[model samples]
Target: MQTTKKSSGWHLRDVIMLTLIAIFFGFIFWIWAFAYDAVAATPLKPFANDITLGAWIMAGPLAGYLLRKAGASFLGEFLAAFAEMIIGSQWGVSTLLSGLIQGIGGELGFALTGYKKWNSFSLVLSTLTSTIVTFGYDLYASGYTSYSLGMLITLFIIRFLSIGFFGGVLVAAITKLIDKSGILNR
Candidate 1:
C-alpha cells in the first residue's frame, strides 16, 4: 500500500528528509549551473540552452511528493537554490530569486490540487508551471527579451519540455524508487 501524510506541520523526519533532498538537488543544480554556462558558451546557446532549465526545478516536486505537506515544494526548492548559491552559481545572488520564484510556481500546482495529487499528471502540471514562471523571469533577467520572437518562442518550448521531463517525470521516478526502498514510508 502507498503511504501519505495528512499532517499539518513539519516533523523532524520531514526536516531531515527535506534537507537531504535540498542538499542533493542543490549540488545537482550547482553542477548544472556550470554545465549551463559551458553550453551557453557554444552556438547551441541560441536555441537549445533553455532545455537545461528543467534540471533546476527538480527538488520542488521531489520534496513535495516525499513530504506530502504544504510548502514542501517551496522550501525544498528554496534551500536547494540556497545551496547552489553557497556553491557559487554563475548567476550570483539572482539564483536565490530564481529558486524562490520557480519553487513558488511549483508549489502552485500542488496547492491547486489541495495537496492531494501526487501523480504523474500533477507533477507534469507542476513542472510546466515552473517552466513558465522561470522562463518569464529569464526573459528579463537573461536578456532573452533581446532575442528574436522566434527564438524566444523556441526557448520557451525547450524549457517547458525540459522541466516537464526532469522536474516532473524524472523526479517522480526517483521518488517512486525511494518509496520502494521502504525508507521514508512516504
Candidate 2:
C-alpha cells in the first residue's frame, strides 16, 4: 500500500471564507474613505491618512492569522481592495494598487517567520512592515516626499501607531475571539 499526504493548497471552505472577509472589509474600506475625507478637511489633515490607515489594513492580518496560509494575507488585502473598487470607492482603480502594496506589506512579516508564528509578536511585525511598506509607497504616490523631515518623521510614528492598533492589537483580539468560538475547528 502507498501512503499519500494531504495537499496543503487552499480548499473550498478557505475560498469561501476569504471571499466573505474580502466583501465585508471592502464595504468597510469604502465607508472609511468618507471618514478619511472628513478628517482631511480638518486642521489635522496632515495626519489624517495615518489616523485612518489602520482600519484599511485590518483585513490582511486578520485573514493571514485566520487562514494561516502562505498567500492568504495578500489575497485578503487585494480582494478587499477589489471589492472596494466594485463598491464605488472614491479612489477608483488606484485602490487596487494600494491593495497590492498593502497586501505585500502585510505578507512580509509572516514570510519572515516562515509562516510559523501567528502570535502577538508576528502581529506586531506585520504592523511594522505594513507601516514601512505603505509609508514608502506614500512617499512617491501621495507626494509625501514634499514634506519636511520632521513632518515625515511624525507621519511615520502616526502610521505605525495606526497600523499597530488596528492591524495588530485589534486583529489579535478578533482572532482570540474566533479561536474561542471554535469555528476553525470545524
Measured by lDDT, the strongest candidate is 2
Per-residue alpha-carbon lDDT of candidate 2 for residues 81-160, written as tens digits (9 for 90 to 100): 99999999898899999999999999898888999998898889999999999999999999999999999999999999
lDDT of 1 by residue, 36-150 (tens): 8788788887654576888988898888888778889888998899888888887789889988988888998888889888888779779877987888888888788899888
Model 2 pairs whose backbones collide: none
Overall lDDT per candidate, in order of appearance? 0.82, 0.91
**Top TM-score hit:** 2
lDDT of 2: 0.91
Q: Clash number for every model?
A: 0, 0
Candidates' RMSD to native? 4.5, 4.7
